[model samples]
Target: RIGELFEETNGYVYINLQLASYINDILTFLFAFCCFFGTIKLIRLCRFNQRLNLFIQTLQYAGKELISFAMMFSIVFISFICLFYLLFVSKLDACSTLLKTSQMLFEMSLMKFDAHELSGAAPFLGPFCLSLFIILVVFVCISMFITIISDSFRRARKNINNDQEIFSYMLNKFQRWTGLKKANEEERYALIRLEYFDPIEGFPERVDQLLDAINRLYMTQISERSRMEKDEF
Candidate 1:
């Protein structure tokens, strides 16, 4: 039905394809620019510790804006891809007709703007070059996403390890305060009991444990990746 409509309108798919290509290019450029510049600004904000409270607040605000922008950009690009696939893949007869027409237009000098000259000559180059470019861009984008996710995992893992160390340290210190041996399991357990139940200290040991466990679970993949790298090298 869409193909018939497009055919009646005289190969609108060609214009759609060209527009999709340009939009995809623009989106890729914007994604790269935002990721690069936003990362730099975030790093700078992290470095300037004088206004710690205000810095954290501003970071949160900036994060919300970035997330909104990214979501909108992703939605727009993905919609274009979905629409293109529907027209080009689902309606192959119409798509083939449109491609052939485009080629004929290129040959007969019907188009004032030549796609061959646009792509630096040789327009009907079997789609390999354009496909390769798209594949490479997708690969880079995926890699960047993976890198960001991996770093987040690393940070979570480090925080978990640090929390566990702190917990152990506190346990040892409380044991010492109670005049108990560090090697005594009974004494260590008693110290933990006192740290939480004791009205004087009243620390939230269970909450701390839960937070540490959550962080550790998040970091598990990153830690596994690190172990694999170490083993490989």
Candidate 2:
């Protein structure tokens, strides 16, 4: 698209671009996508990593909520786009076209819009609509979107498996097997006591600790009255 636009256009006397002229641009675009896919592949390869795995879990868990939000947002966003394009199409250059109006409104939602440019077009309707957009779209809709994602993220983080524990377990195992495990990490290891550190000893795995922790958290809190009665008795 960019190459087509940058092509020679002298009063519609279009001139074909030489391969050498736009080849660099074509290569750059291809390389950009290559890097992008490569990065995604790297992330996929390390999907077992703690934070990355959590983020993946969050998106998976929040799929329904995100889809609903996207639907609602599209309706509201498109409505405002038409509203702005209709009201300011003759006045404001930014809202001159449907696409431009949408772009401007997206910028507005991000708080990147210029109020002066909008207000200068239609003094009354411009500021009025701008303020309305700021209040409803920027504040209300965007905030709701954020709230939904955050709530979903909270649920995801809470329910997601603790991959960090698994990663640590694997790392420690590798280190131990290679005789490269650090003393500090050995000290931090709860599986085996420092005094009882031996290859022959019965070692409790990190998975057992993780299971116990999950059981503790999964159980409901004890009643205060029951505890008080037990203490009194």
Candidate 3:
């Protein structure tokens, strides 16, 4: 009956599809494993040689750029494939009459029936899907690698900024603590009088000298404060 023939045809088609998918999965896994391990090994070997390491680092940067471009490219490529497959290829091979006749002439015509149009779809789809799958997998891996590098660089920049801010803050605090405000005019004159009139042996007139330095520091502090406010504004 025609029903039996239709069932058999469907079975053959399912078998072919299943076989193609299996092969695609196997190929994709192998390609990913090899590419990943090979890249890591190449980087490790490059590290042992300074010149080679520089070369590899340069290559890695270029590779990342290319990979980003490829990801964008793959999106377009997949879109084209889907459009072609759904709108064009799927309409060609939905039916076949290759086994309907007994005569040699009928058989030849039947052979050409599936061969001329629908036959190429299976072969092309297998390779196309395999290639697309591989590209997507590699693209995702590259993107993740780039993301990690970007995050690390961002964190490093933040840390350096924080360290510089801390250093400046500590320096300012130390300067303020060690360098006192200058004394007034009267205070300066008093200290000068003390240095000349009250002399202590071996004490070095410490208080009077200290007062003079404090007077000078007060003037310097006012100048510095004006400069700081100007800079802030």
Candidate 4:
């Protein structure tokens, strides 16, 4: 029945490969547009919060470290491919070309290739050499990659904490200058919440209040000084 319907409708019931390709292209464009729009909004939101901004900066630095690690890994991987080809090129019929050799080595590193295939290719010592390659690639190299990523994450976290400490120190200085008491736990929580809001809209009122308090304190001190001087005369 399905074949009869297709024959009757001249295959119009199903989408052709070209139509599917067009649909895929349109969907990809829409996805890209959404990602670009979302990124802009996220950046605007980050600007309102010191902690978020610092986190983004730390992430950027960590990305640079990851990119460097990737470059080094590529070099090492290619070197291993060349070394494997040189060692077994004559014995292995599959590794007739550099590309084929790289593919074979990559598969072996993932433990997907058959051990017997290596033995068949290079009978006497193939198994031992392949084991060494697996240990070097899968164990040592992969572990180093994970360690590099872990170190980058730790560094990013440390930098973020340092930035927060500096911000807290500055906030304390401002409180002292305004003759205000140290912020209580609740006030600190509120300040943290305020960091996510529009700085220009919400921050100025608090600053203005502090400045008014400072002015009042200064005027009272001046009046007290003048009164004492008059009494002495």
Candidate 5:
């Protein structure tokens, strides 16, 4: 059915022709799968090491900053594109379609578009105003985005350290609960280190008391069982 609509005899079948689109879809899916697999491997590696985990968290925070920036940028960008389209829709060929007008303005904001296109459309004033807009976006808006990301990195770094310490403390507790008490020495030291860095009032003392109580209870039960076995014998 697709072949009938997109027959070869049709003059100049664009690359978006049915068969080509199907192949493109398949390739795009495969590419996406490869990227997903690579990301999973990177996350696994990060989980295996504390430093790598911190780095990945920093990246994640940076990504969140970028997403927020992009959202704000998009609103401003679309507003400007609409203003330009309304101002020179008939004057510029690029503004013939809203999509094209937006694309042209976005490229101009990046200083990537041909200035002559705007100049040719509306002469001197057109290029001048567009140039000013681009300068403002590149210098002011983009600089603010960079600052936001930098701040996010700083906050993420601090949080990552605190989170890792807390995680180590919890992991130690888990091990102790699961009868791996001997492995908790390192965890105990970690908790002590955390106390020095960030004072959690009475938390360390409480955990130590709990552990002691568990040990004493286990010992008392064992002694009672041994006594019972001797009487039965």
Candidate 6:
């Protein structure tokens, strides 16, 4: 059918052009989404990155809250959708169908909705409902959503497992393999002797200063006693 469209035809063609076009569109849509999801899956391979790992951990911590938030959002959104659809179905083209109504509401939530048409339709109720939706969904619900993610991120950062060393090891190995970084003697020896080394230093600068002070005091006392004995003799 697509081939015939390219060729010069003089006769009456009984081709269902819409069918082929629709089929092509559906395939294109599926291909686009498949590519998107495949790219998202590849993120798991790069989890050695600290920022990416932290983001994943944050999501994991917020999973339950997000699910519940989704449910609450859907309920409120659907209620508004149905209400808008029923009230403005005959008056506004944007609310003529469920899909259009939902899309229009989403646009409203994003503050991209053109309210002139709606206001022209219902005069008072249109502006009132729009204000109500912005307050309830955009301000309140979205704010709660942000708060949930923020709290979860804070918790995740605080409670993150001490796998940072492992991630750093992976990154270093990868860099060395890619020739982006080289393994120096110090790093190599430190890596090898990591298990045998103590993480804390036994003698700090403060302890060294204290020892020097004690030695100076002892020397001063001894010299003073010798001077007094020599004077007495």
Q: lDDT of each structure?
A: 0.53, 0.80, 0.55, 0.76, 0.78, 0.90
Model 5 local distance difference test score: 0.78
User: Root-mean-square deviation of each candidate, in angstroms?
Assistant: 29.1, 19.2, 24.6, 14.3, 13.3, 15.8
Give me the runs in candidate 2 sitting further than 4 Å from their true place: 1-41, 183-233
Candidate 1 local lDDT, 64-168, one digit each (tens): 445754685466445434433344443333224545433432332322433343243324432443344244434444455555545544444443324335656
Query: Which scores higher on lDDT, 5 or 6?
Result: 6
Which pairs clash inside model 5?
none
Clashing pairs in 3: 182-214, 182-218, 183-215
> Which candidate has the highest lDDT of all?
6
Model 3: how far residue 131 lies from native, Å: 20
What's model 3's lDDT at 119?
A: 32
For 135-181, candidate 6 gives per-residue lDDT tens digits of: 99999999999999999999988977756779787878999999999
lDDT of 5 by residue, 1-233 (tens): 55765676474554446787899999999999999998888775456357777667777778866887789888888787787888788988888888988888778767788887778877877877786777667777889887976787787667765555677778767877898866457667976887784447778988999999999999999999999999999
Q: State the lDDT at 16 in candidate 5.
A: 48
> Model 2 misses residue 66 by how many Å?
0.7
What is candidate 4's lDDT per residue for 66-117, written digit by digit as tens? 7876787788778877776887788776677789988988888777887887
RMSD of 5: 13.3
Identify the runs in model 4 with alpha carbons over 4 angstroms from their true place: 1-59, 62-72, 158-233
- TM-scores, all candidates, are 0.25, 0.62, 0.23, 0.42, 0.46, 0.61
Q: By lDDT, highest first, what's the ranking?
A: 6, 2, 5, 4, 3, 1
Local error of candidate 1 at residue 163 (angstroms): 2.1
Segments of candidate 1 deviating more than 4 angstroms: 1-73, 76-80, 92-137, 150-161, 170-233
Write the number of the candidate with greater lDDT, choosing between 1 and 6. 6
